[model samples]
Structure formats: C-alpha cells, structure tokens
Target: MKNCSNFTNDVVYSIIISFISVSCIYGQIPVENDTIEDIEDFDIIDMESTLVEEKKDSISWVSDVFSAMRLGIQYGFTYKAEKPDKIMNNRFSFRLEYSKSFLEYLSVHIDTKMFTFLKNDHRIRDEEDIVALEGRTREAYLQTSFNKTSIKAGIQIVVWGESDYAIVTNEIGRLDYREPLSLNMDDLRIGQPMLTIDQYSSFGYWSAFFVPYSEFNEQPRKGTGYYYDPFDGKVEYLKEKQKGNFSEYGLRWRKTFGKSDISIMAASLIDNQYALRMVNPDLITKSKQRFFMTGVTFNRAINNLLVKGEVAIKSEKAYNDASFQIVKKNALDASLGVDYSPNSTFTLSIEAVNYHIMDWSDQIQGIPRNNYIALLALSKQLMKNNLSLSWASMYNGPYTNFFNVLSASYNWNDHITLNFDALIPIVDDARSGFYPYRDQKQVAFRVLYQL
Candidate 1:
C-alpha cells in the first residue's frame, strides 16, 4: 500500500516538474510584431460571424500560450435547515499553460492545474466539499495545425452532447448531499491524455476524441464480503486490493442549418480486471466490462422563440453470475423555452424540461425504477450587466413534490463577483423523500475573484 502511494506521488511530482520546465522555456519566447498588431485589432464580436476568418485569426500559438497564466479564488458560506448549522469553505486554484509555434504548420500546447483548500468546515464533509483538491496535474498536451484539425495528448477534458443544466457523461462532479445541495465545481474527472480531431466549416463544427484506459486515483474500493446484522440490514466496507485500468472513447458530430443546430454523440468504456470486479462482479471473469451510451440534441430558434431537447440510451453488462445479461436503460429529456426582450434593460425568459429514466429488470432494485422532473426559471438584469436576479423551481415527480432556488449576483468588476443561492422545498412526501437533500431549506453566499 505504501509503495503504491509512493509511486502515485512520484508520478504526480514528475508531471509537475515537466510542466514547469516547458512553461518556462516557452514563456521566454519573444512575441512578434505582426502577432501583436493582429491581437490589438482583433474584434471578438465580428469574429463570431466569420467562421473561417475567425478560425484563422484565433489559431495563434503565442497568444494562447501566454493566456495560460491564470489564477482564481472562491469562498462561500452555507446554512442548512435540518442541522441549523453554518459552514464555510474556501479554495484557490491556479494554472500555467504554454503554447509554441513549432512550425507554421504545427503547434504544441501544454497546461497544468494546481489547487488548494483554503478553509475547512465540518458541516460539509470532505468528500462533498466543492473546494477540495484530489491531486495536481503535471501536463496536458495539444498538437494543432493552422487548419481546424488537431490532436491532443496528456490530461484534458472533453465535453459533448447538450443538456441545459446537467450532462450524462462520465466527466461529472460528485454531488454534495450533506447539505442536500448540488454544487458543481468543474472538478470532476481528472485530465486524461486524448487524441482529438476538429473541423470547422460554414455550416457548423465537428469533433472526435479518444482516451486510453486509465484508473481514477480517488475511486473507492469495496471489501471482499458483505456482513448482515440484526439491526442493520447490510454493511459494506473497503478492502485494500490492486487497482485496475480503464479506457474510454467517443465520437461526436454537429451541424447547423440557419437558426437550428443538431448534434449526435456516442461513447463507450473498457474496464480491466480490478475495476471490473469492483463495478461489475459478473464481468470479472469475462476479461473486460463494457459500458455504452448514445445521445442526440437539437436546438432551434424561430423568430424570438428557442426550443431545445435531448434524448439518450445507456447500457451496461451485469457483473454477477449472470454476467451475460446486458441491462439496457433509456433516458428521455426535452425542454422548450422562449426569451422575450422588452426594451434593452428588461428581459424575461421561461423554460421547462421533462427527464425520465426507464427502469431496468426487477433484479436491479435500489435505484428508482422510473422518475420525472420539471423545471421553471426566471431572470432579470438590473443596472445593465452589473447586477442580476434569478429564480428556479424544480419538481421531481411522485417522491418529492418540488425544489425551489433563488439566486442573485453582483459583479463588482470584470474580475470579481459576489453571489447568493437559496434552496427551498415546496412539498414533502414520505415515500418520495428528498434524494439530493435531507432538509427542507438551505442557503449559500459566495465570492469569486479571477485573474
């Protein structure tokens, strides 16, 4: 165990050293005259309309390389109704990225991120805390051409599909259930080296990514056997064992026709022995465990009306003695909303979505066999873009009646902002208890600074 920990640390340290060395070497490269002039005359709004011209201008290795030096800090306080407790947490995150023009036809990019927890609070468990840092990244690699095509290697993130507030991909953050709140902090999956190809055309854009198998350092392990007690139905614990490797690959395509856009994506994972045993015991003896998913999204705008929707299907092979059984699950989600702009200072928009998860066989028990959700949101801007107020309500069918959220934000400047979030429960049911939160109400206040 100690050896494994040491080896993990060694790998992390080596990655950090390499990142620093490359960043320093590239940081010393002098900016050229034409590059400086081009950046100065660059217009962000105009570039959006000219796809080909924008792509050519945006492909600057020097500007992207230097833009990698960034720092950020966040702090927040929370109050929960059930516990009647107050907790605070803070975080500081930094990244250094470097890009260089190896030749007119090729460019290299590297990025590294380091994070630190600044404050601790017990009401929020470490596992549920959004400010916690699991580890530091050593390097992220990207090799791109002047054209739209590029291949990236090293630790990085790839996002596909389109869901308003949530995504179905593996790159999802852990939810904080202690306070019955979900706060995503962009700290989900670690950076994995991947190869990607991207193309840009007048119609739209397309990208594809492939990631080799790798194990998550923070993934939990289960003990050998389960124990049953008279009072407690069943108890499980962690056991020390050899970890395994896993790899994921995906393909995505998108096209735009006038005001309407469409996208389709598919992804699959291949897990090795140890991981297979932990996630699917039925597949342990089969050499590899597989998980597959496919999704589609469509967004269209007619006049002042905008509509968007997504649907997905996921399947996984059982792990137990019935390893041959492949359980299939389906999810259907769709949202329709419209934005109304009455003058420039006042704007109002409303949207609603329905999420449904199909039930598997009776054998798969604990999970909800079927579920549905609906949401409504409203927003207003005050004093231009400096201040804003918003409210959202979510109803989770049958179980919990509804959840409500109210938020307000004040932008002190371009680099600093303050915000508040509150969660309220509108209905309560015994069988449909709150799945994400325990209490009826919770509130949080946060401050963020970017550099």
Candidate 2:
C-alpha cells in the first residue's frame, strides 16, 4: 500500500511538472474573432452582427486575455535584529496575476509566486537552503453564478474571521509558520483546493465549503531555533491514504443589520496548530490530525470605534503525555477586540483573548488550564500618505512572554516601494511560546516594483 501511494504521488507530481513546462514553452493565447483565416466559411455580415452583439454584452476573449494581468518583482534580505550577521534570507521573487471576466456571471483569477533563497552557512543551509528554488500557485479559481448563489472552484484562499493577529474563528487554510512571529497573519496563510458556494439575500449571506484534502502548517526546519522536535529526530509520517478520511467541510452564516455584523461557523478539520504531536504510544505524528471547531463571531461600529469578538470551541485536539503518547482533549477560546481610527492618518487597536481546557490532566505540563493573551497595534501615516509606520505587540499573560514587531514603509512612487521590519521577543519562562524563538530576533528589508 505504501509503495502504491508513493507511485501515485510521484505520477501526480510528474504530471504537474510536465504541464507547467509545456505551458511555458507554448504560451497559448486566446484567438481573435476577426483573425480567422477561413473567412469564406462564414458570411461576413453575420460575423459582423455577432461581433456587435458581443460588444454589447460579452467581451472578446482575445482582447480580454491579458487585460487584467499584473506582474512585478521584489528583492529582500534578512539578518539578526540585534547582532548583524550573514543574511539568513536572501530572496528575489516574481509575482504574477491574471484576472478576466468571461461574462457578467463568470470570472477567473490566477496568482502565482516563484522565488529563490540562498544560505551559505553549514548548519542552517543544510536544513533550509537545501531547496533554494520554489514555485507554487497561490490562487487559481473560477467563480460563476448559479441563480442567486455564486460558486467558486479550484485552489483559493478563504479567511473566515473578523479579529486580527490571533486565531479565533479563522482556522480554515493551512498556515505557514516557518518564521514564526517574524511575519503577520496575512503573510502566513497558504492556499488550498476547495469548492465554495455563497448565497446572499436581504437578510444575510450563507457560505459552504467542501475541501477534499487538508495540510499541516509549514514550520521551521529541524535545525532552526523554533523547530519543535520532542523526539530529537525520530518521527514517523502517516501514509497519505491513511489520512484520506480527514476531509475538511465547513459552513458559515453571516448577517449585517444597522452597524453590527454577526456570524456563526463550524468545521470538521485537522488540528494543524501543533507542529509536533504524538499519534500513538510508540509513534509521533509528522502531520496534523483530525479535530472539530465551532465558533461564533461578531463585529459592530459603536460611534467612533469598531468592536469584534469571537468564541470558539475545538475538540479532539491532542495533548502530549509524560510517556510521550498523545491524549485527545477539548479547548475553548474567547476573544474581544476593538479598533479606532481617530483621524485619517492614525489607527489604534487592542485585543484580549482567554483560553480554557475542558479536560486537564497532570501529563499536560507546559500548558495551563486557564491562559490569556493580550495584544495591541498602532499605525500612523506621514508625509502625505507616502510614509507609514506601525507597531504591534502580543503578551502571553500566563508566561509573561511577549512578541513585538515594528515596521516602516515608504512608497517612493506609484511603481516603487520599500519596507523595513524588525522582530523582537521578550521571554521570562522556558515554557513560553516565544522562548523557542528568543534567539531568532531578525530585521528584514524589501524593495518592490510594480509593473
């Protein structure tokens, strides 16, 4: 069975590679209606009449092919924040996008990223830069209308919550935490394949999703400081077929009335939050496991301030035992956040969250029964909207640990921009989340050109 699964995976990957290679070589283009060589086969007057009708409603595929495309390039580098050393992330990347409307009811969007990274260090390079070049389809989806309902198919991104900087109700997509707290939530999500259906009415909107597969979070490499390897290097990965039953399915209902918006959502998905989890008494899991999450969220504008709140209960999550086996448990989390933009150039926001474990035992040593996290964010724009500065900090109240970041960006022009960011951590206990990343303080800069 294992051999067969490996063969199937290899074939799928090989087919994908071949498809990309052929596409790059051929550069297939849409056909123009007026460029047909066999014009004698059709009446010229009828063709002209059809063209006129198309101009009134439908768009010419030839002219619409690349009309909505955007392409750009960026270069970035990163180093230790406090102590300058050799660059850890030396990157040059290409960003591409193409979108077009086939009809009033149908549309398509494509986004892709290709990048390379280089590291020359002995220890770090072995684990990270082993594969310096990578490419992936960020989003390639087709959306169409079915009566009053709209459906989207293919690989795409879906964010399902209101609060920022923390995960309360937004647990759908696979998150990439390779750099941990160095990056924000927006940059940490990875697209996945799903079928989404949305329907809107005077009362509210309803959404449903059927996801065929699930994925684990992309964590730091084994040699990295934040890598979670309780077994040092001994771990086992379950066969792909063994995980075939872990399909993800979800539903959400949202409503807006007056100045307030509310939603309720539920999903059966894998718990990808934990990077290292034990699967059995003798084995540890190399990927995420099954879990269920149900939550409610709300947001409202109260005069000058906007408030958002979420409460989620997750079940079937695994907790490690002293003997190394994992035990399934339930956890509940509640959070509230409020944001205020006193003026056009400045904004302030604060969030508070509390988590409780329904099933607590002595084997869960590092985790507390009742834990809390507090967060604050501030941003300001200067120089007439060209220069911007922002700072965000998150405090783990139970452990007295903090994660802070400060960023500055300047838009040189409509076509060029520059960004600088720093990540700093404060840890007082070894069990804190930031303790693993304490030595990972880093500074990064990027220059981007919009094409």
Candidate 3:
C-alpha cells in the first residue's frame, strides 16, 4: 500500500511539472498598451479615452497572471521537547504550488505537499514514520467579466467571515485537531471537491456551494479510541463502522460599507455520522448519528480600532444507548475580539471565548463544567516585511490555568519561508484526570518552499 501511494504521488508531481513547462513555452506574450480598437469604433464623443482605459485594464490583468505563477519553495526544521520525560522530536516539510490562467476567463491552480518527522529521537528504540499526501484543485471552472462573477468546481478553497486568528468551520484546520502539537498552516482552510457559484457587484459578494457527500470519504480512519469513565467505572470501546455519507450546503453574503465590512454565513452538515459500538455486546446496537453546526461573523475597522467576532452553535442527536445516557453533550462556542494598530508595523489584540456545553444542567451531577478562555496578543512586523514577531497569552478560566506562546516567521521570498513557535505553561491546575501533556511546554520550527 505504501509503495502504491508513493508511486501515485510521483505521477501526480510529474504531471504538475509537465503542465507548467508547457504553459511557460506557449503562454501568451503580454502586451503593454491602453487602447481597444473595437471600443474606439463607438460613436460616443469620449470613445477613444474609454477604449484606452479598457486596454490598460486588459494588459494589467495578463501581467498579474504571469506574476502569480512564478515558482517558489520553502524548507524548514522543527524541534519540540518536553522536559523530565525527554520528549524530543524533529520534523521537515516541503510544499510546491502553481497557478496560471488558460484564458482570460479560465484559470487553474495545483498544490502538493510533503512532510517527514523523527519522533522522540534516540530516546525511543524505534523511530516513528510520519508523512502525508495533500493535493488541491482550484478555479477549474471560472468565467467572469468586470463584475467578477464566476462558477468553480473541483477541490477549491472557500473563505468567508472576518475572524482574524480563529476560524469556525475551517476543514483544513480540522487536520490540526488530529495532531494537536503540529504548527498550524496559514491557509488552513482547504477546498473539498464541490461546485460553487460566486457573484460580485458594487454592493459586495454572494457565494454558494453544492458539495456531494461521497467525496468526503477519500480519507479513511485507521483505528478507534476508547472512552472511560472513572467515576462510574464504565468503559465504552468504539470500533470503526462502515463509512457514512453526508453533504454540506453553505451560503455566504458580504458587503463593505465605508471602512467596515459585514458578512454572514449559513451552513448545514447533513447526514453526518461516526461508527460506534459499545464494549459490552448487551449495551446497544450500532447506528448512525447526526450532527450539525451554524455560525456567523462580523468585523469593522473604526480608525485605529478593529473589531471582529464569531459565534457558532453545534448539536448532535443521540443514538443507540447514548440516548439513555444520563448526561448528553451539545456545545455553543463564541469569540469576540478587537485589535488596535497604532502603526502599519505594530498591532495589539485581545480576545475572549466561551465553550459552553448546553447539557450542563444541575440535574446532571457528574458532567464536566463549561469552559471560558481569554487571550491577548501583540505583534510587530520588521525588516520590511521579511520578519514578524508575535506574543500571546491565554487563560483557561475553568481550570484556572494560563499558557503563553511566542512565535515568529521569516519570509525569505515568495517561495521560501521559515517559522518558529514556542509554548509555555504558566499555570497547570487543569482538571486532574486529563493528560498533563496538554499543559506541557514545547517549541518547534518549520521551513517551507515552492518550486
């Protein structure tokens, strides 16, 4: 299986290179001028002037396309260590992406990634193998005029809302949840294979997506985890069941008025489910469960002060024996924040979040308490956009604990970049039963390239 996956990956890379080579050889030679002959034929008194402006716009558009396709590469090293236990690790990663337009109304984009890592160093007897294959498709179907309306399908990213540091329904960030310790990707939002319609006018933009449920199953689960209850001495072991199907429908509307922008999104996850089976055969029969989430965001820039916020509510219906369980869990998560930028090079931001479990009723005696988190961050750009530094502190109120993070990034060019991130635990009075590693201090670095 590994060999086959690698072989397929190599083939895709070769195709990407071939396509870029052909495009470079036959691509149109951009023209520099500001007159459209057809427009000059019009009878209007100012026809010649209007035609020149239109021609300039056409020339600039072609210039932008070629610049966007320039090759770039990034490479970096990341190291993380937790004291006492000697949890030392290192990782290396690389990425390549290309973008070009076949015509004025059609464009294409492709991205490929590679990651490798060494876990626990020599402290552990065996080395861990870590790698991932990721690819993206964008602008496969597009057509537009001055109004900027277009249609797109295939794997493409859809970005909406105005929250700065946090995203509510970012599927690409979902991968980070699977590896909580890894450095976050900047474009953490990725495109699933779906059909999208976008329309833009003087007011703003409106977009909608029609994604089929079947395409989401491209990734498979390797195993399952067991959940245990110490207070009641109960254990629930879940096994992977047959993959389920679900479709996501989304709509977003945004408008910019003066210095402020307002946007809203409505999305639904239909027929979502996870495979589940209890350790005890007599407990209950297996069945599919459904879950859904809804979110909204707003942002405004008032002079030196910029503010943004988002709120989301998620709910899932209980199935099998879960319905009979004494304590069910549903959640509502929200965040509000503001940033003050005294200058173009420096900014300060403060944000607060609440993760409230709606099922936390007094009648449910053993349930975990809701959580509140607050964060403050300051950032500075230096060396003419080559270097950036940021510091952040977060307090998780429910546990009466705090965490601090210091991070920096250096962009050598459009292709190569480097990043450094560190996490420090200032307070660790978290709920006793949870793993202490969640509150441990660690640091890591990463480098990336595009070619």
Question: What's each prediction's clash count?
Answer: 10, 0, 12
Residue 31 C-alpha lDDT in model 1: 62
Query: Which lDDT values do the candidates have, in the order given?
Result: 0.55, 0.77, 0.57
Q: Which residue pairs does candidate 1 place in steric collision?
A: 15-138, 154-193, 180-437, 213-246, 213-247, 214-246, 281-319, 282-319, 282-320, 399-432
Worst 10 residues of 1 by lDDT: 221-230
Model 3, residue 231: what's the lDDT?
27
- Model 2, position 225, has a per-residue lDDT of 40
**Candidate 3 has what TM-score?**
0.66
What TM-score goes with each of the models?
0.63, 0.80, 0.66
* Best by the TM-score measure: 2
Ranking by lDDT: 2, 3, 1
Runs in model 1 deviating more than 4 A are: 1-68, 88-120, 123-139, 168-180, 183-191, 201-204, 214-234, 237-245, 270-289, 317-363, 425-433
What candidate 3 gets wrong by more than 4 Å, as runs, is 1-76, 84-89, 118-148, 167-173, 182-190, 202-204, 214-245, 270-289, 292-294, 315-331, 362-369, 411-416, 426-436, 449-451
The full ranking of all candidates by TM-score, starting with the best, is 2, 3, 1
Q: Where does model 2 exceed 4 Å of error? A: 1-63, 119-124, 127-131, 223-228, 234-244, 273-283
Candidate 1 global lDDT: 0.55
Candidate 3 per-residue lDDT, tens place, 1-451, comes to 6467557755765675556445444553434663343233332325335545665676577667657654443444334454444444344444545566665767766655544434533222333434333333322443333347787767665666444555454322122222333223344433457778888878778888877752332222222011223323344434335576656777877788877777777666543233344545334233444456667777888899998887777675332233334223566778889999999999999987776777565553322456677888899999997999999886766667666779999988876678888877655564622234454567766676654
Which residue pairs come into collision in candidate 2? none
